[model samples]
Target chain A: MSATVDVAVIGATGAVGEALVQVLEERDFPLKTLHLLGVDEAVGHSVTFRGKNLRVRAADEFDFANVQVAFFVDEADVTRECLEAVRRGGCAVIDLSAGLPAGQAPIVVADVNPQVMASLKAPYWVSSPAAVSVALSCVLAAIAGQVEVTRASVTACLAVSSRDRQGVTELARQTAELLNARAMEPRLFDRQIAFNLLAQVEEPDNSGHGALERRIGNELKTLLTRPQLKVAVTCIQAPVFFGDSLNVSLQTEAAVDIPAVCAALDASPAIEYVEPGDYPTAVGDAVGQDVIYVGRVRGGIEDEREVNLWITSDNVRKGTAVNAVQLAELLIKDHLSKILT
Target chain B: MSATVDVAVIGATGAVGEALVQVLEERDFPLKTLHLLGVDEAVGHSVTFRGKNLRVRAADEFDFANVQVAFFVDEADVTRECLEAVRRGGCAVIDLSAGLPAGQAPIVVADVNPQVMASLKAPYWVSSPAAVSVALSCVLAAIAGQVEVTRASVTACLAVSSRDRQGVTELARQTAELLNARAMEPRLFDRQIAFNLLAQVEEPDNSGHGALERRIGNELKTLLTRPQLKVAVTCIQAPVFFGDSLNVSLQTEAAVDIPAVCAALDASPAIEYVEPGDYPTAVGDAVGQDVIYVGRVRGGIEDEREVNLWITSDNVRKGTAVNAVQLAELLIKDHLSKILT
Candidate 1:
């Protein structure tokens, strides 16, 4: 079969933006023509998609009139600009950036809540949860149905890619400089990222909760459809160049059986459960992985009411880009089924 | 009052061993003769103290008969051998190594447990807890006395210096190779420690808990004096060269006020509480600090019974060497007062 639909990739040069292009091609999504859009300077740069070199177009200059879907994978400000144009042209928007169309947009993780998402109206403005939240909510969605989770506490170690291309470049550059005994200046991040763990994100809003910390908590509630579930989220910048790891503790309403919880996690489509005798590490097992690789599953020593889990996932592929692409697939399938009938 | 005490620093060439020498000099501890001892090869190597170059002697061959105090800072095995010889000679052993006469040793964290330690016997074989446990317990000791702490969950990012001189050197070597796009192998650790987070410690005991993980829990329980306090500890080896950060959550027996807990923490001399508007990071705030830098204190959302704390400290100074030295200071105040009087 030939290509059937046309989609535009906004913010084509970002870490997640670049990953979106790859995920689309790797998943073999039905593409009539892939439109690559970015800033004015990147307009002439080319990205290879399906053996064809597609020249990037400035997002402001391009018309989104007939675009079937537009994936906005840039920073919040740039995404806000793209969202306005995409919405005006009645194009379906899959947002990976923090900027979603302000009001009542459903933050999504495709596998976690597909049925609820399918019921949304056309030209839907969809927001995807952050990487840490997606990985966490996927595992929780499996158990939230089986048991009532009263609270969750997560300490996440994010990869360098979360800052986009600049993040990855800065880590590589600063790391080399430090090893050579040269002084490194912090630019992309607030402090040194060469071989240090940053306790906070780039910006710390009032409550002492950094940007990444706040997002994880908010998104957890949104994805799990539980607005009141207490979540304590601490996002630290790990020195690793790829893969994110989260140490999560969940307190259920009642005592939970360890064996039953493991069985539920194994059944979840979005998570790959690591059985006993085998543990998962990001560099060894989770790099380039498509699922939330979960292991070290057990109950708390004194409190069986609590469940502890160590989860690792590829921050780029499964974190933002791939999830945006997955949501687009769901958007197409659900919308296409209606038009065809 | 010229120098009046004879002290020997075992494992003088290692990280903690080296730091122990520095702490002793900085504190202006009265010394008659400072004997630095390690293996045979390290014996002729000199370290400067108060403008004098003191040469190291072989630890095994050095006579412990006249040594008033000996600090064992090497690996458990080396310290184990030294403990036996030192005990026979009636020398007071302040052990930082795992080896220190394991059976009935009282593990001390100088500031946290001086009262309990003052009553111990002569020639006390006192062991210090790991850095992670020491930091966690310092804060918990404050809260546990005020509020009943049923459980504590900690996720600590450990520095390379926690291992020793070899660990610090290995990380530097590995980081350079990776940045230069060269192949690197794991030697001192079980896996890569340059820019990666290891899933567990070098050795994994049957319960699936790594060496560091098991030690943190055992030490926390011992320090808190609650033999049954349920502590969940996850120790991840970070790529950084110094400083350690821990994300700790405490489940109190009852709902507690956040401000009251902060007041208790502030009252604790060992902890420096960062009030609102300011936070702590490993590299920027904690690298060479003495106190357990605590900030980001908040109540758990939805679950009011849980308390969250973010703590960072110098792994070598506050974690091991400094704590060991403080124990010696305690020993002098407790025992020397009796002799002097």
Candidate 2:
């Protein structure tokens, strides 16, 4: 394995993409060279990395063979389009766009399912799950030692940034208009998301489950390797701009020990466990942090076997970018030689 | 029963109180006289009823003996202070403050538990549950006809108005401040409530459940008449000005029949069912509506015995005022003579 590897970041101008570059710099990731690539309007935007202005080039024109590993931060359609090229270039791929199916590239959370990486060969392709799934799996995987979860239900309050920068712009515009006593014309979302909760983040299938909701459920199961676990997910679009907050309820085989669960969360490096009396909010505690903020941890009202949790996470940083980087770190630490060969 | 009955609305200056007066006027209740009463700051205000402005008097000095029924909408402390006088006045009490314990005044939702009225005597002291409870019970009770729900978990995304008119003002203030590039100074809520999801609406207890969350759980159990049912409640403060949205997951004894569940929700007069592929939001459909909007109904991804639903309801109108009026109508229809004596 080399001391440093050349890396390319696709979709370098979006929220997650911008954060990916920032996280790589913040963590001082070992990189010999960094290539910023984007598509359409994203191309030519300048992002600051290591005190240098790196201009994003067209992702369509960039040669994937130049980099040892590539982080795909674009939307699923774009990621799907470039998959073959990346494979042909023999570059390892870490997907944050949820483009590749789990069957083709296993969904791996660095802290939760790093073991999955050991089974991969050259031209390694790994997928990072959605932000909600990443936040949930971090805490749930920490507590797997204490309880065997049979069923889990999550109500994820997603930020507008999940829709990209346009979402952030629209929320600010809608809010300003509404505040100044002007009419609100919702743009990015179907309706006004300024100060309201949209029941579904996207249109659902016939079964009444939205695409993101299904993706979250599938990712959690794969990350936990619990195909039989019953996961019910409802993803609502919140007016928030930065972080995602989730209300999770789990049914376990045995009674949940509250203290034990707290201890487990407290010990996890990926989570910051707030005490029972104090809770964490997305804006107040988790907007820019590197770790998921977990609080409001307790048992059920009537059933001892039930456990409820409130988790707040930085949607872009820790949930997506930082996680992808951690996976990259693991690959560089153990599988770098195989990929470089 | 007489042709008309004198009614009094205590704490008639706040959000719920204001909605209560409007509902009474909209419903055209058989009221011989309408009295609007309030506490210190609420006095001197006027509420319009039947096209006439009604002055708000001091609740401390008002005579409960003058009205056959009184709707207590003040805080629990005020409700407690005035309870003795009301009982002595032989006035039928419909408490909305949640001031009285369940043992002292049984919590009742008109549609969910009309039969509980038969168990009451004169000088009725019936309690209206919290807005979240009313909204949830309406939908859950409707589904109880189709499935035997053994457990229910809910994530209630409450609007800012749940804290009263002041909460609404603070969110608007915070949002405007943030939009104009000014610093946010959170007042009503512990932290910024604008464009954020607050994990706990109120301070939680040692067990990590907030007062409102616990109240919702207990109220659901009582309203459903299922003492052994497991209920998990998490009330989050959302940025919305009005309308509360809840993501509810229920576990029934048998596999949930999707068609039957949809039919039951559709048939319920108190609920407005939204078909699959389309959904409702707090601002889009339920701000001032009288019926609770139910949508996103589906089964769990892996568990057949689970059912998930998204519900949006006017916390002030349908949840509190309308439900209270419906209870008043029920009392008038069957037990009016007993109270008028």
Candidate 3:
């Protein structure tokens, strides 16, 4: 932790990637140099870091050996392509993409399972869970010691930004066209997402689970260290521009102590617990926040063992960028010396 | 079946009320006279029934005794105020506003529990469940015969129209204002309902359950006749304007038979079972439809006893108007003599 560390951010031009860079600056990371890199489409874009514009370079041409850590914020394919280079350079990898499966790298959420980092050796590789998983896990982790969660059902209403820049542009265009009483074809999404909810963000496999849905479920189990926990997930695309709204219901082994749950949530650094009377919405509360907003907390209508929660999290800021940056902080605090050696 | 029936529709200017009139006309109900009644605000408006303009008269002045049955489609308060008059008028009541408690009037979904109608005595009063309840009950009922549902967790993504015409107008106004970068105050909803997801549709009770959420849970229990079945519901307001989208996960007593479940859903005349891979959306598949569109049907990620489904239903059409009309038809077919006498 003595010397400043050098880091590279892949896919620097996308929404989450840009937010990652901004977070790094805002958090004042101990960085000697910042490498902004992306695929060919993003090569010409420039991102501001520490009040200086850094041009995004071609990721394939960048030398990963120059940096001690690399944040893979690109799509899965790009991450898969650059994994070997980062491993060869002996750089610690914090993947925002679900490129490396759980077996390849343990999924880590800084607020939930930072202790998982202790087992990793040099050139550490960690996978960051999806935004919904990150938000849910943090809240779940805060209260896990009080009650054993038996099962959870989550309905993730994802913002257009979850699909990145193209998604944001399409939503704006579609909404404008519809407002103007003009019919327009949907691009990026399968159907009209301007004022409609797309049931699945992506095409489901033969088993009918959306890719993101399965990923969130798996990530929650891994991050929470409860492999046997039954997690049901449904990821639907919302018309929202920037936040992910989740409707979560959990069943615990015993009756949930309402006061204790609220106390735990309010005490968590990574969560902002909203009171019962007032609730949070994605646009109204979580659009640019660093912490996930949790509200409308209540027990089941009949079963005291059940708990319901509404969570709104900024998909780019808290969900991806902040968590990834936080993971980097943990890496530097505990494993910096190992990586530098 | 014996003779044409006379009917009165209170609150004939609202979205559901108008749709109810259309459905009645489309179904070609055996009708000698149709009475469209409303409050002071609706007194000047007129609804077209069977190709003729029917003026909406003041409901407080209208004699309910003129009609054999009355469809109360106004607010809960209005419905409550008119209940005694309707009862004194000896007019059978189908309360769509949920004004009367289940004890006073049995909540019924035509497709799921038409048998409940047989239990009613003369001047029968029945309550049409909420849109979410009606849609979910129909789907759950179709599969309940095959698998004993031990528990269910539902995320009801409601469209703006659920709030009625005002809600629709407010959403359009908000979206327009936001798009134009004009800051405007939220009208009906607490916050922006244009491009955001509101965690709860209404002010939740002290227990943290929204009124609609609790009602849906109770209605499902009564409709399925599974009083002991555990039902958890979260009702959220989505940006969509017309259809109500529901994400339902059910845990059965035994492992779900996917093929059998599909067969039952397809066989049911009340639902249009969508195959895997292709899903139904609120605007694309369910709006203006008579049947609820069911899609994204699958088993759980790891558990075989779990089944998940996505349902999009026309909240104004199938959820309320169609169900109410069907209930009227049911009453007329069976209790024509009882009512006329």
Candidate 4:
């Protein structure tokens, strides 16, 4: 455990990838060296890590022979291409793309399901839930423990940063341009991400469940230890740059008292209860935050087993990068580094 | 019925009052002369009606003696003040303020409850539901019918204009000032209200229901012909200027199909079904419309007797003015005008 480990970060230079680098530095992960890989167009370019410039390598040219862990943040197809190579090279793979390993458990949040990583015998992949879903699961688990979650309906107010670095730049550029009396051409999103909210996502199947929804449902089941919990989600892109908010209404098996739920939430370390009287929680307050902010807890109605709450978090950190790094930290702490490496 | 009727509009110069005059003109109500009444500050201001300028008079000095129908658009206290005077003047009073008539039945959306107005005699008072509440009732009636509404959880995306004319002007002035590189001093709303939504409303009573919530509950009871239904509402203010959108989830005794509910909604003349494919119905599209837009109809869960839908409408029109005028039209059609005038 004292020896530093070689890490390969695929999809380096992307939003989540950049955040992963920052998180690795922030947490002071024992890194002997870091290998950055991106598309062929980004090859030979450099990304600064820990005050040193690391040249971006094409996925085809990446030397995974000595890499201990390969963090796959690339697209699903690209991750699929490099999965076998990294695994064959004896590097543990942590895949962040939507692709799931068949018949394998893709651990969701490291804090929620740390034991799931203990059973992995080789370089295995883990799937992170969507930003909103991660934020919601963190919030909901703190309140209604052991309760049957019959339904979960969320209105996701997503940020432009969820799209990637270029999307973040385009959102800021378009918003500033509009503010400076100039016209904007939207390219990152299907609609104008300047001052509007769009509700389209990776298309839903015939059952009206999109890829994000299915991922969230499967991930929540794995994380919460409930495999049959039903989840209905509506994801919408908001005009925010970072952080996403979910307006969640849960139908539990038993009636929940609002005060008791708030007390339980306040006691949880993963949640920071934003005072409901504060009026509204803005994206500015949520940016770069580790703790998910929970507010607006209220009872539903007489004889109805439902409660509503609003949860917000920084998608890049708690939703993706920090979560992945945290899982790696847990693995090291639990003496599973030998297996992972 | 063809004869000219003297009409007195209290709360003139206000948002709903302005829309009331426009609705009357648009519907060609049989008004020989129009008298506008407001507080002392708004007195002497002239508003044009039917291509003619009509001076606004003080509510205290306005001669309600000759007016056939007096519309009270002022606050609840002011409406209570002039209710006796208007009644003593032998005119039928239609109160739009939240003040419910002591013993008279309040009519909500004349098309839905025309008989409530038809039963009115001389000096009888009729009241309409709040804008958001009416929108909710309209949607619920079409979907649930006479089924016992076990519970209703509402999240209102209200507009600043719901407060008064000052709110309307403040939002516009602040938006323009922000666009013009000037600081915005918002007085009507508690917060910025430019690009954010706030959940600040009149504080809830001992039973945890605010004025808007209580009014919505009572109004729905009257309109849906169910007096025992329970409702839980959370009203929030959004950046929109005119329309209010509500995310409503209701539990009923019977199950409802999505298409059947859509058909029921389409069958109702007062509602317009915005298809699921066409969403994000902004305030601009719903400004002057008289119909409530209902869409996003989906099932709740596996065994839950509930459904969710998005409801939006022009607060000034379908929620208030147009509904009042429609009630008056119903009175004329029912030959009840002779009972008052």
User: Considering every candidate listed, which one attains the maximal lDDT?
Assistant: 3
Question: Which residue runs does candidate 4 get wrong by more than 4 Å?
Answer: A1-3, A40-48, A51-55, A101-105, A145-149, A165-204, A301-304, A339-341, B1-3, B101-107, B145-150, B165-195, B200-209, B227-230, B301-306, B339-341
lDDT, candidate 1, B1-341, per-residue tens: 23257889988877787788888889888767788998857778888777888888888887897778888877778877776688788888887777864566799888777786788787766888888878888888877666788877788888888877777899988887887778888888877777678655555554446767777888888777888788777777788788898988888889978888889889988888988556787888887778888988877655677888889999998888889888877777777545533
Tens-place lDDT digits, model 2, residues A251-332: 9999889899999999999999999878899989999999999998899877889899999999999999999999998888
DockQ of predicted candidate 1: 0.54
Instruction: For residue B237, give model 2's deviation from the true position in Å.
Output: 0.7
Candidates, DockQ: 0.54, 0.86, 0.88, 0.27
Q: Per-residue lDDT for A64 in model 3?
A: 88
State in Å the error of residue B244, model 4: 2.2
How does residue A340 of candidate 2 score in lDDT? 53
- Give the worst 10-residue stretch by lDDT in candidate 1 chain A: A332-341
The numbered model that scores best in DockQ is 3
Model 3, stretches more than 4 Å misplaced? Answer: A337-341, B337-341
Over the true interface residues, superposed, what is the Cα RMSD of model 1? 2.2
lDDT of 3 by residue, A9-50 (tens): 999999999899989998888899999999977898899988
Worst 10 residues of 2 chain A by lDDT: A332-341
- Ranking of candidates on DockQ, top first: 3, 2, 1, 4
Q: Flag the better candidate by TM-score, 2 or 4.
A: 2
Backbone clashes counted, model 3: 0
Q: What is candidate 4's CA lDDT for residue A115?
A: 76
User: How far out, in Å, is residue A83 in model 4?
Assistant: 3.0
